[model samples]
Target chain A: MIKSVAIQGVKGSFHHIVSQQFFDENVNLIECLTFDRVVEALITKECDAAIMALENSIAGSIIPNYALIDNYNLHVVGEHYLDIQHNLMALPGQTIIDIKEVYSHPMALLQCKEFFKNHPHIKLVEDKDTAEVADRIHKNKLKGVGAIASVLAANIFNLDVLAHSIQTIKHNETRFAIVKRTNSEVAKEAINKASVKFEANHKRGSLAAILNVMSDCKLSLTKIQSLPIIDTPWKYAFFVDVTFETYADFDKAKSLIKIMAEGFKVLGEYKNAKL
Target chain B: MIKSVAIQGVKGSFHHIVSQQFFDENVNLIECLTFDRVVEALITKECDAAIMALENSIAGSIIPNYALIDNYNLHVVGEHYLDIQHNLMALPGQTIIDIKEVYSHPMALLQCKEFFKNHPHIKLVEDKDTAEVADRIHKNKLKGVGAIASVLAANIFNLDVLAHSIQTIKHNETRFAIVKRTNSEVAKEAINKASVKFEANHKRGSLAAILNVMSDCKLSLTKIQSLPIIDTPWKYAFFVDVTFETYADFDKAKSLIKIMAEGFKVLGEYKNAKL
Candidate 1:
């Protein structure tokens, strides 16, 4: 039923790429420049759902996005792990020597900075979006400037890739969350992963006791992030991800965690993406 | 001999404010526009130390800074907590009604978004630095534009305060870490807080058991963040912060954690900033 999905970039950004591969290829894209807007589109009923980058292999968790999900009362219905491949591209017939400056997102530049070190002549310029830079290069016929982006971006902008997979780390991957207003309609049997939020008591060994509860339920803890409760100084709300092979085991853990921890809320129940 | 310190912005950044308060006010600053350069300045001995924002009460951990500290082998020698106060400033005699747009760093703008919502006529624009925007408005004598920055910025840029503490959260605070090339020079008895990094074996309840060990030793866990090991997919390097009333208790817990965990490394042992 997802006819249109909100993405935080243009046609060929990583969010767009994930949307294309995970959902129907022909699904409409509601392009937004910021993650806030992507959430806005979902709340305003402009899109059926949204795809958000949750974390990166090298950079770690996108903590604010987790905050937004909790604040907006959105549900993470599923997830996808995308192997990030950044390529240097420019207008057709341009060589690496001809490039005077390279434009890309700050993170992309950080990932591929070692490659640029070899070519000292090329200046690195931080840009907002990689695909937007490539599109501008092709649209304005700008010469001597290159952009580090995905291969899909090169194709969408009709540019030529000067280098393939130029990122410094070859195994870089990013996790994306598919979010919607309501919980996913998938069958209960398909659910193996669940993300929950809770607060540990002020007493000593509170978090340890909660972790022991998860362990006793035979739940595998995948991710855990602590978010500050702004109203209460020095207190935190823990966001956790756990996977299990059986629904009964997960249900038992959920019930026990709710009793052991304060402010417990199950954010999502979805099938394991890697599986 | 902390004579020189590196900061990520010009005169009135949050980093600069914390630096001035933590170190000597006259400490020469090696200003770097990016954290990467800040790390570089430390590695090259361009500065004696650096003040980096580790986490904000509302925004949670600055994950990449954690990665940079781990990867570059920098040691956190000290810590400070700053109460963030966002002030709206403009040219002299400009009233709130006279302003048409407010500019600040994206996080600052987001923090103060609720304050601007009542006045829809005034647009909110995202800029690189809060103090830099205030300086620009004062330098160019630009009217009808306001910038959300610190009181120090208003004094430095000669701007009038239109409003004080415009951030939505009244009790917002950010924690900064004073870092250097080698470990801190403080006396061992003065240290109560410590940050350690470790990876658990591929066994069930491994992390839970580690947390239990710390609890048994009377150490209070303040924060824990997971960083992905690039070579091993799904494996994480946990960065943990703990505080203890007695050094003997901490040593007991540290020794046990080293035996129970893999790739264990103590990043720093310093006095608790909040205390």
Candidate 2:
């Protein structure tokens, strides 16, 4: 059983919420300042597991996370999707109209670009984290400054929610993965999913060829993303996630992909989601 | 003859170098703070044309550029590749050993993660811009702080170069495109290269079918990238650049591709350096 988890944010951060969702309620939590530190803590055995957001429906994939996941060789044990609820937060006694400047992460600012455009009088400032931005706004007592953050941030910092679901898109969910130091036995509560990385020949139809192979093998591909192959200029390797009916025939599909691809690796075969 | 060009960044930025290479040195230059501003300047008649970085040799595509180009009907007029030189800089009298913290844009920091790992004593801070970080270090007169920026930044900010070419890869280069608000007649300097973006049907082998059409037409594909169609989750649209032997059959090939693809647009036919 997991006893503790280390995440990279304050108590009201989205990461913290995702971490709690992945681990037991009784588990102790350690908060780090950066995502890299969260990975470091898990690799150094300071934490049992770490929950990292891999992609958002509004912003697409978190590209850096893909590179980190590949470099760290961490095993993704499970996954969860959080419906992101962005709110306009301000110190008590302040209203939305009073906001002269808004601060949040670049992604948050981007997700709420429409709001900023509608309120052209407000300046958008990018910060490290949304929750951290709320804390800073509250602690500094900055007048006429607002933060686009989660409602949890308002609750934790004792601020007022000026607006709710300010994102232009309603389907604002972020996909998170629970990563462990090593592969563990599939927990009964976990769903079955497989993560894969593969490189294709520089030929024109390489990607299409691989997708055909997946279709032929009857693998239901859930996601596919391409990252530049840093070692080779103008070449790319793809990362994919697939769901199978069962763990059965996993090796067969893996072998078939390997035979068809120039290079391929199973990042991890694990239970998907219990949430 | 082109009189002036607008680009993103300060005078010594890589984009500046690319613009100079694409246009004559005598051309008047307009500087913009952001990529969108560069495009807006062209669209609003503040500048005749804009030169923007589209992809980095080491960093892959600058994904947002694709959307910007698609959203605005800009025509690619030319392309150039510039070799990037990343440097570690610090205030005068501060050496690498004396630095306890390093600041840079997130991409630069990620590119130099290995160097940070080797020197675990230093803390990595993410800033908005590399040049901006260098400027901050100079203005603040801070000690024990360094920045990862371009050598041009070190020179501009009067900072000393603590380390040179610190990126993990040596052949780091960025590809930039010259775009105009309105299409121009094909010039003598125009080469046999073209870029296109298309969306295929969400069915098995749809992308393969498009690639097959390109191959059958004997078009040599230079690069292909897929960006998520945000409106339609789980679906992707592909952007491809191809080179042909002559302009004689270019239109025919493009028309065939359009017929095969569910959605397609010819970005431009331009002369570009052959990789």
Which one is best on lDDT? 1
What is the C-alpha RMSD, rounded to one decimal, of candidate 2? 4.7
lDDT of 1 by residue, B127-217 (tens): 7788899889988999999999999999999999989999888987888899999998999899999999999643457889999999999
TM-score of each: 0.89, 0.80
lDDT of 2 by residue, B125-211 (tens): 877667777888888998899988877778878999988998887777778888988775667346588899888644545666676
DockQ, each predicted model: 0.50, 0.25
Off by over 4 Å in 1: A97-103, A114-127, A136-145, B88-148, B157-159, B166-171
Identify the leading candidate in terms of DockQ: 1
> All candidates' lDDT scores?
0.88, 0.77
Error of 1 at A95 (Å): 3.6
The window of 10 residues in a row where model 2 chain A has the poorest summed lDDT is A184-193
Worst 10 residues of 2 chain B by lDDT: B200-209
CAPRI level of candidate 1:
medium
Chain A fold similarity by TM-score, each prediction: 0.96, 0.86
* lDDT at residue B140 of model 2 (Cα atoms): 93
